[model samples]
Target chain A: MGFLSEDAVATFVDVLVRLVETAGAVIIFSGCVIAFVRFLVLAVRERRVSSFTRVRLDLGRMLALGLEFQLASDVLRTAVAPTLREIAELAAVAAIRTALNFFLAREIREEREEIARDTAERDTAQRDTAQAAG
Target chain B: MTDAVRDVVALGVVAAGLLSGAAVALVTRAPLAGLQWLLDFLLAAGLLRLGATGTPTALATAAAIVAVRQVAGLGLRRARAALAVPAPEPPAPSP
Candidate 1:
């Protein structure tokens, strides 16, 4: 049996990084498409623009997840950065992506909280009405 | 540390973040605020460590991101709140 060479290992890592990057891009694209379709369906059925909030939250969550993958790719690229210039470029890219991820995550959290609160209030109102009738 | 090992560690940190985010998203009813806090700390620590030992640039980048995100989040929340509020009613017609 032949053993793998050091060059082969390096090549494998390179391939893996590229694959991860591609996967991240694909996730963002697919997630956005799915969210848009869902939003359209709900809006058409409900005839209310406010229905978009739910879909927007869902999409934001997906985008945040995709941003994680992108940041990972950026970190992986640092491994091969031989020059200061390349490293600087990676830093800039990472900074922008991370900032985007942070806001996206925060937005998703706030939206989720709002939705939960609305549900709780509605449940309480219904319970009160039932008690009054009884 | 060798570049390979460093890369592996960075990848692991990111993978953990992804998993934690997914977990938070899936469990709807429970308040997983603690998990969210933990995730933020973990990512911050990981990035800082990488920057300190392997690349200082990573730390700077992460710090800038954190600052920008905080400001942006505040602005967005304010905008959304404003939109949620109804406009003032028009004055009653004078006889």
Candidate 2:
């Protein structure tokens, strides 16, 4: 019945937990917004033309990378806090995520190069075929 | 020591060791793609560290700076190549 009741302390802790959760969410949201803006700026600077098809590809890749970045940041902040055990767990997760990104980036670059090479070969083949037909 | 400093030093040593190994591999004409794996690990650690600290805006800004540096480097190389090459004559018209 006193001011020092256990219930009061429990309620206070609950409120503190909620505040921390809310702050974490806000951090992630702000990260996403920043990523979107950066994407827009890069697209413009790159002089990218916006065909529906091309735009879709560009947005997908950029957003995927951005979100990956955001997640990576979240995992990092986990370790930075005072929970040593949680830090170890999160560090493992971060390592896996990084490996995934590395492989994905390499695949993307390789595919892009392959596509360019194929396009050039196809063009040469078409020209040869057209010349023979004529 | 701070995690950041520890990571940087670790990565630097790894990079240096890999470079030396790569040089040895080059002499032996062996594949050296494993160096790239180390780089990938460092990149992941760096991105996570960046994410842990400041706001998303700061991370985005850093990413933008990296992209700009890459584009500028490419453009410079292209311009240099252009200057080095003679312009090709117009294709001869079909007889």
Best by the TM-score measure: 1
Q: After superposing candidate 2 on the true structure, give the runs of residues whose Cα lies further than 4 Å from its correct spot.
A: A1-64, A75-80, B1-95
- Candidate 2 at residue A92, lDDT? 53
How would you class the docking of model 1?
incorrect
Q: Which residue pairs collide in model 1, if any?
A: none
lDDT of 1 by residue, A1-134 (tens): 13366566557766766666656655654554565466446534653323445665665676677678778878887766768977786787688677667666766787789888877988999999999999
In Å, what is the interface RMSD of model 2? 15.8
Winning candidate number (DockQ) = 1
Steric clash pairs (candidate 2): none
Residue by residue across B53-91, what tens digits does model 1's lDDT show?
245565566556556545644664676578769999999
Per lDDT, the best of the predicted structures is 1
Report the error of model 2 at residue A129, Å.
1.7
Reference-based lDDT, residue B66, model 1: 55
Candidate 2 residue lDDT tens string, A90-111: 5654554455455446544653
In order of appearance, the predictions have TM-scores of 0.57, 0.33
